[model samples]
Target chain A: MQLDNTDRRLLEIIQRQIPLSSRPFADIGVELGIGEGEVLERLRRLQEAKIIRRIGGFFDSRKLGYTGTLCALQVPRDRIEEVAAVINAYSEVSHNYLRTHEYNMWFTILAPSQSEVERVMEEIKARTGIDSVLSLPAERLFKIRVKFNVSEVPDAE
Target chain B: MLSEFEKRVVREIQGDLPLESRPFAAMARRLGVTEGQLLDTVENFLERGLLRRFGAALRHQRVGYGGNALVAWVVPPDEIEPVGNAIAAYPDVTHCYQRATVPGWPYNLYSMVHRHSEAECRELVRRIGEALGIEQYILLFSTAELKRSSMQYFRD
Candidate 1:
């Protein structure tokens, strides 16, 4: 769907935060000079198009008493689909992607505790029979924030 | 301004700060508010859970931490919570989580490790394996970074 100006404005606003006020749509309307109902409708449409994946809280895991790490696993060429399915099933695995690499399947997961993280890895090895796996932990948190530049890039990629 | 309006302004600025020297000032101007007002809203947003943090995004390869990998582990269904908690406690483990395992690829828990050298990253993984008591895992390192952009939830 071609995003109109109002759609773009809504995207710009919602990317930051979904207004938490009772009348969030109304509040957004006030700022963007559009009607509250229009804002709500636009948001619904965006979601329907799958452009806006989810509207949820983004937390600082470090502050929330949870630690995070990025890990990659090298699966045999034929086992990509099987491995991807395994990684995608865990609730902790928020984001998983199939990438071109020696490991081939790259994914990121977030756990509430550290021990859980280790156990998950161990289980993967025993099940997959792929002993060559590397877990890269964050040495320093340089930057962590979502980016929204739909204005610059066309809506449909 | 009403507290809610102030919060809306804060949410907008916190998530979409342009990569500029005077980001606060730029945001204030865009929102048609004073810099002081923007600062106040930012403070409030920080108090709430809406804004996680404000920081820079770096290119790991450019900075020499080019060696990166996504690691996964399979913990028994009952022991997932305990194992995840133990591994996440380590400072080096930046991102960790649990996922469903596919047939032949049964590793479930996953983490991302970034290191200046490949060897260093491998060594850390070895240590994490021993530390977690999970001797088996698959280390999938990136040969190329195709796309690594933070999700733009608000964008259409």
Candidate 2:
């Protein structure tokens, strides 16, 4: 994953904010003094390497009338895979993880309403036979932006 | 607060955006609007704060980031803002939030930290704790990522 200076610059500028234009790559190319084709080729390579997940719109789920909760459960170590499968089956469970704690199985459920999110959580409890979960819905979003500054770090680690 | 047109735009563009010379132009063509009009809609959405960020979200794990943990800390009510800023200053700490506490649970501040390995992750957490000087915390490392998805506001 040794990214050159240009690759680093592309990562930095692309994530800061995408130019809202017809020829957005060309606009980015103008900044880097590279051709639009070069920009596209590098981006494609990044995607192939899974460095860039996707270049697209990021909307506010809450603002769009959706509610979510970060849920934690004390899952049996032996049953992690089986239980995770059942929980992850639900589309509402956007993020599910096996964490290191008494509450080992953690996940996030985002749905159109509170009732919907609760229903899905309850469903997982019944299926996994876990009685309770720390369903901590955000009282207030203190921070959410997660832009990693590629420019600050060097290529070869 | 989304208009029908805005909702339509979101539904159409929430996936992997096309990657061509004129990517936005391609999207604009698909949405049956001129490139300028589409850009205006996006700008308006941004100005109004409907869109949080419009850019490429890199997958850090694939980009050489190792283990990640969700560390929940019990912070005093008075020191939340300063402590939160301190925690968020670390580049490895991607998401930091003040969440609600349960009946017995005391953690109010939560942070998602990434590092090259578990040891590295713990070291960073320890440093953050020493810097802030207020820490009753637990690190919940993610052993597996079961589901990670972008919220589809319109269709969903």
Candidate 3:
């Protein structure tokens, strides 16, 4: 998708941070030297295009008394969809991906407690009959910020 | 350690914010609080490090970063910090962490790398490996995103 310089800058700035104000869009417009209406219009288009998945507060789950772990399973190629459905049934499971590896199904489960996460994992294993679920919890978090460098994207203009 | 009202605020803002003028006012109407109160709560969350950032969660693939791979590195205990930092320094690498490796699967450090193309992703991975002098790594390319959603803290 071609993005003009203004749209590119908007994407970059919004990813870094959005101000906590009643007129947050206006605040962003002020920074980008565009009107709030223009900012909203561009953002609406971006959201529709699925470029901007969401715009909201990113809370630290751990600080909020939640625990999470990354797990992977070596599901048979034939049953990938079935196994994924069982895994995704749990609200605790936030991210589930089919990756290219022996342990092809990789996912992350976040819950209010370690036991809750474990319970969900175990249930997923039992439901899918994939017992060899590797639960790799984070020993250390070096970084988690997911801001992409949109400024580097060539401007359509 | 949050009050009832604060918890409600957190639940309200955890998902997508409305795209409009005075969004907080719209949210405030739902929560029976003033827009000022909601903004203050969000600011406090930021100051307390409870909220990482209020921003757009982008789809990197749509924005020209099509190549995505999860590279897992088996770094030595003594050199984990330097190697992790080296991986984290790359802007394209969004997430970096040291995870507990299982018995058969022996990869301790993990980094999510994104680039414009598969070749570029491989090249960036090569550069990172060269800089860190760590070759024991495997890149796992995601074939499909089955599920992706933000954590909903207080379900109401």
Highest DockQ scorer = 3
Q: Is candidate 1 or candidate 3 better by lDDT?
A: 3
Candidate 2, B1-156: lDDT as tens digits: 788888888887788888887777778888899889988998987887778878999876765566788999999988988998889878788888889898989999999998877899999999999989976999988877767776666673
Which residue runs does candidate 2 get wrong by more than 4 Å? A151-157
- Cα lDDT tens digits, model 1, A19-118, are 4433456777899997766766776676666576445445455553455556667778788777766766655565565555665666555665689777
lDDT of 2: 0.83
TM-score rank, highest first?
3, 2, 1
State which candidate has the highest TM-score. 3
- For candidate 3 chain A, which ten residues in a row score worst on lDDT? A148-157
- Sorted by DockQ (best first), the order is 3, 2, 1
**Mind giving the per-residue lDDT tens digits that candidate 3 earns over B14-49?**
878998898889999999989988888898999999
How high is the TM-score of chain A in each model? 0.92, 0.94, 0.95
| Clash count, one per candidate | 71, 0, 0
Q: How many clashing pairs does model 1 include?
A: 71
Task: Return the top candidate by lDDT.
Answer: 3
Misplaced by over 4 Å in model 3 are: A155-157
